[model samples]
Target: MKLSELGEIGFLKKIEASLPLSDKSVLLGIGDDAAAVRVSRGKTLLSTTDLLTEGIHFDLKYISFYQLGAKALLVNISDIAAMGGIPRYALIVIAVPDNIKVAELNELYRGIKKTASSYKVSIIGGDTSGSKNSLTINITLLGEAKQGNIVSRGGARPGDKIFVTGTLGDSSAGLELLKKGKRSGYLIQRHLLPAPRVKEGVFLSKNRLAASMIDVSDGLATDLNHICEQSKVGAIIYEDKIPLSKELKKAKLKKSPLNYALSGGEDYELLFTVKASYIKKVYNAISKGRLSATMIGEITEMKKGMLIVDGKGQKMPLLPTGFNHFR
Candidate 1:
């Protein structure tokens, strides 16, 4: 049952038999040297890739192969969502270790395939290789959007309001619980399977509701700094405005949940900016329960610098403390 016994070619043949081509956009799928895809006229292509390595990005002891596979593809889907695109195709390359069983790899592929299909994505092609000790999954996702419907991190301007979808810090809180040997908690599930806000991002972009947007993968502070750095603008956010989940709020921890909201990574929520004139429309949607988001701050002039106003109205510099692979 080991992958070594089946070998790469045999394993690939098994995978090919399991996946049927359903999307017309994918001219070719698995078993091809490279995938051939079709792009609609007047549409822009959005491509994003992510790499997850065992021990560095995840610990297999705490996660199943199925969960790991789903998370790997979902994170890449989040990137396409941030760009306001509809996911269409994927290239999944994995490095398998000798200790892994063929059944485990099948479960992993099932996870990726299920998540991909849910988002209307086709698994086009990928390469498999042998690894000494670690399992690595690298996914390249391809998406499409109308030329004018794409959002970027650099479109934010001064005086624009900052907003984020859903609650924050739940994933990090879930991670904390996992470290303590706790399982089956709500917080733990949030950490394991974070959802991408593709509908929200697309709606905002198509409606021109958001001036700029980015997913909160590297924590709010760091990802917001990405927008700031890209747009060459400064911002001021209120501490009390940062949204927190009830589950995260109830969890007892060494540090405040607010701290996790600020710098804890992998929330996969969308953080965006809306111009002042469009603020009313956004609030209207929020009031109608059509949109789930909170206005946290406003963009400021670059010279003003990034700052956070405390509950007492005290101002201080906002720093990026999110997860950095090298740091």
Candidate 2:
């Protein structure tokens, strides 16, 4: 049935009934004017929000409402993960177009519920409104971290080693493959379902392994530049050190997969830095299979500028080519 037939209040009732509302940290959940949540003592609250619009952030032709819903929440979770916090509460707001069926929106919420359950997050509240043209989804996520454990992009220092979790460029490669009418591949799954590195972030923060960190949503170069700018430092990543998945390496494409790794966005992996003294600990973790990370380069002085060194030891300025909403 159409949303118009159910009316806004009826639709909201459905949502309230379908989603779990018994989280211990939540004093009040759906059906309230505002959500009430509890934060443990000595914890810092982390909040982040992201907006996804049809035809801009995603294409319905290639993705389902369920996938889109899950992805919408995951992206926001990634922001919290970058800060090394634990996600706990969510506020979802969506603008539904008239052409969308009520069942479809239910599927969307189902996806959100499933993802939230996996992370032990509670969907406390949200707003629904009618859209004139496109479907727009926005999620506000709240997380918590020990007062002394929150990591930021501004903590990087000169000489700190840079590292990233998981292979890069797969999401963009998956996207490109989808654009070419290819389907049912690892690359495509990477694009459709990005796994946020929440546990990795927590591990790094608890162990004091990362000096600075950011998620690879906007490509390596652009996101690294963010860390550089925030920390008042520069960086130099090796061309050969950027990790690429086997699928991405074998995929035939017009541009180099290296380009995708360096410039393509939405990888959702963690890009972090560690002090030289902590390198041994990081390697130890890796050797013991506790962490999946690779040292790509080292932070440099701001005067040195951001650069990428080739396999032949040639240096070149690193440019930011990641997705920009207003670019």
Candidate 3:
């Protein structure tokens, strides 16, 4: 059935069916203005907000409202994770049109609650208002880290090694698949539900392995450029060293996956740097059986700018080409 026919409540019921609540601190889930939680001492608070609009951030034709709600919260949690913090609470504000049904609103909240519970975060409070045409969701996540343990985007030193959590370009590849009307399983899932590396981020921060970190909500090239700009350093990413999903490889063989991986946005993985001394320690903390951390790059002097070495060993200038609000 078309989304318009489902109204809003009908859509919400569908989403509510899929949620599994495991957290005990969530006094109210999917039915309240906010979520509540308890926290311990010696922790500094971390907060971040992400705003998503109907046409600007997503297309209703391809994305489901349930997924939209989950993604909205997930992206903000990713920002908190980028700072090496544990998400504890969220405040969600939604602006909806008159055509929206009460059920659809419930479904969206279901998505938010499900994601928040998974991260063990509570939804605290927010505001709901009427809008003209677009459905807008603004999520503010509250997280915590030990005192002075928060990682930032500006701490990468000259000799630090650049590392990334999880594979890159999958989201972009997934978007390409949707645009092409292809139904590849991997790409579709990647696009619909990109997991934020919160556990890994907390581990890195607790162990004091990461010098600085940022999530690749934007493309790697653009996000890494952000690190460079903030840290006053340059970086060198090895082209062949970039990790690609099998789905991405297939897409590349058929088209240009590198361009999408490098310039496309919404990867949700953490891009972090560690001092040369902590490289092994950080790797040891994040390494799983197969998904090992690869040394894809290094921080360089500010005068060098960002560079990418092609497989043929040629140095090429790196341009910051990713999602921009005003571009």
Task: Please report the candidate that would top lDDT against the real structure.
Answer: 2
Cα lDDT of model 1 by residue, 52-95, tens digit = 99988999888888999999999988887887778889999999
Candidate 1 local lDDT, residue 17: 82
Comparing candidate 1 with candidate 2, which one achieves the higher lDDT? 2
TM for every model, in the order presented, reads 0.87, 0.88, 0.84
Q: lDDT values of the candidates? A: 0.86, 0.88, 0.79
Residue lDDT tens for model 2, 3-61? 76775446766898899867776543553212335567666667778889999999988
Ranking by TM-score: 2, 1, 3
Q: Which window of 10 residues has the lowest lDDT sum in candidate 3?
A: 27-36
Alpha-carbon lDDT of model 1: 0.86
Report how far residue 312 has shifted in candidate 3, in Å. 0.8
Error of 1 at 264 (Å): 0.4
Cα displacement (Å) at residue 166, model 2: 0.3
Q: Which stretches of candidate 1 lie over 4 Å from their true place?
A: 1-41
